[model samples]
Target: MSFILFLRQLGLSLAEIKAILTSDYSEQTLLLNKKQALQEEIARLQALEQTIDDQLQQVNQQDTLQVDQPIHLRVLQRLPFAQDFDLSVVETIDWQPDWMLRQLYYVINETDYAICMATPAVSDYQIDAGCYVTTTIEAASGAEFDSALAAITTHQTLPLIGIEMRGTFLSPGKHLAVKILGNRKE
Candidate 1:
């Protein structure tokens, strides 16, 4: 009904009504402070989350750059053959900045020389100068050695000398030397 009628029914004085209003205002002030504190906390957490996201993005970018640069393979040297000389490998690495030795692989000669010899060191295609790589192969001997002879006999190109690179990068235009030792039937 009317405010005055309601107060009259309750038999409250104006002074008592004023005191109730003051208590209500106090409760509202406490609630407002709690809401403000929560808002500040939320803002701080959001800022931290954004910082973490930025760091993650930077790490991903570095990973992408590394993907563009791959480790490759190349041959460094070969030596005169012994009767049963063990297989030897050679490698050359070409990195843009600085390269670590881990990029190269050394595979020993086995009966399955082709499979056992191929390593990540050798590129399927050519690599450029300044880029680096490694390579391993069974020294051409017996039938395999004769294969080079046959290839040379059939044409000027020596199939045994066929070289491949990882990509279209330029390679070192020189031959490398490596040594071998094992049982010989001479």
Candidate 2:
């Protein structure tokens, strides 16, 4: 019609002059590659949310301690040569030992149970460092075969390769405690 009115006075039109004569920048290079893949997926989810808040602040930091010693029912047999683990759940730990270890685990009074220990770590994997220990016991219900026969007439100084019979279900008094499970693996 006048060369489309001289290409609409030069502002072009006929489909922007056929997309600038075919050099069609694929819709602005697909919106700049979808805005650089959403800014690298928001910088890899903010570096995985700061690596899950620094592993939840290293499990909310811990270095607890609670001792007065008095409770009994011990057994770990031996651990001088080290290297042998199998805490085959002999159940009885209704969970309770975080309130600064329950106010010193209620000041060793007729302790229903508590025998947490750890130190092994010469490389066979690792554990030492703050090497832990928490004593307190009083069992009954098949108390894991009397704690493996009181680790052969007990006289320990921390040498009972194994004895996992934790407790916390007595909230009534008396004795007959139970939780004697087992495990094996040399």
- Candidate 1, position 7, lDDT: 46
TM-score per prediction, in order, is 0.21, 0.19
- Clash counts for the predictions, in order: 25, 7
lDDT of the candidates, in the order given: 0.34, 0.35
Ten consecutive residues with minimal summed lDDT in candidate 1? 176-185
Q: Kindly report which residue pairs in candidate 2 clash with one another.
A: 76-160, 77-160, 78-160, 78-161, 90-179, 90-181, 141-176
The model with the greatest TM-score is: 1
Tens digit per residue, CA lDDT, model 2, 80-180: 22222224332333333231222111101121223333222232112223323322234444454456435532444322322222222213564432222
TM-score of 1: 0.21
lDDT of 2: 0.35
